[model samples]
Target: MVFLLLSLVLGVLVGILLPFHIPLVWGKYFSVALLAAIDSLLGAGKAVYEDRFDFWLFVSGFITNTFLAGLLTYAGDRLGVELYLAAIITFGVRIFQDLSILRVYLFKRFSTTGPQGVSKTRPETK
Candidate 1:
């Protein structure tokens, strides 16, 4: 649950920073988004590695963002620097990714619950 929320917050931050060329954009949002994403990713990776470490996620985020930041830097267009848009894009991508992963798990579990072992008719009201 916390992971999902963190992903969403990070995505929002991503959106904020993505429009780096927009002069009037709020720097705070973008910065927060970037920080949140990195922090969340680090926490997750640390949990996976089971060592209370965060280097992996930090490295991965740094590597991915280097390319992303460079692309935005070169664009120099108002559209290219809009944080809101970037956040929306990030949120959409994460949501879809999670949904797809969930779909696979749900399908697998449902497939195993054959008709004979599962309830069919709805329960009667008391």
Candidate 2:
């Protein structure tokens, strides 16, 4: 998680310092791919917070989701069917859901009361 955050910060800094632009024709693909990547990252964070993180799974999911979202956008362009909407909606919903879960997890872990009282209290220290 620390690595992920650090890399994200570094990547943003690099992107800011660099002036790069995607072709207008491929803008949809780029946007959908970005959304998918964000969803994957948030999902991975949620998994880690839940103690079910898997390195391989996170890597695979990040790559596959980004690729598939881009592919869907490309295919939609070819078919004139707007299938990218499906990818966008799916990833957007997942991102929000993952964020919600993470928020609850953090609040429960740090606060006196848990969400719906699901969080366990730490034993009193001697």
Top lDDT hit: 2
Against the true structure, candidate 1 has what lDDT? 0.51
Q: Give TM per candidate.
A: 0.30, 0.84
CA deviation > 4 Å runs, candidate 1: 1-24, 27-58, 66-75, 78-91, 102-126
RMSD of 2: 3.9
Any residue pairs clashing in model 1, and if so which? 13-33, 15-83, 15-86, 15-87, 16-83, 19-81, 19-82, 20-81, 21-81
Q: Write the per-residue lDDT of candidate 2 for residues 43-118, one digit (tens) a residue.
A: 9888877677899999999999999999988888899999999999999999999999888777777787665656
Residue-by-residue lDDT tens digits, candidate 1, 89-111: 66456545545544444454457
Instruction: List the global CA lDDT of all models.
Output: 0.51, 0.87
How many residue pairs of model 2 clash at the backbone? 0
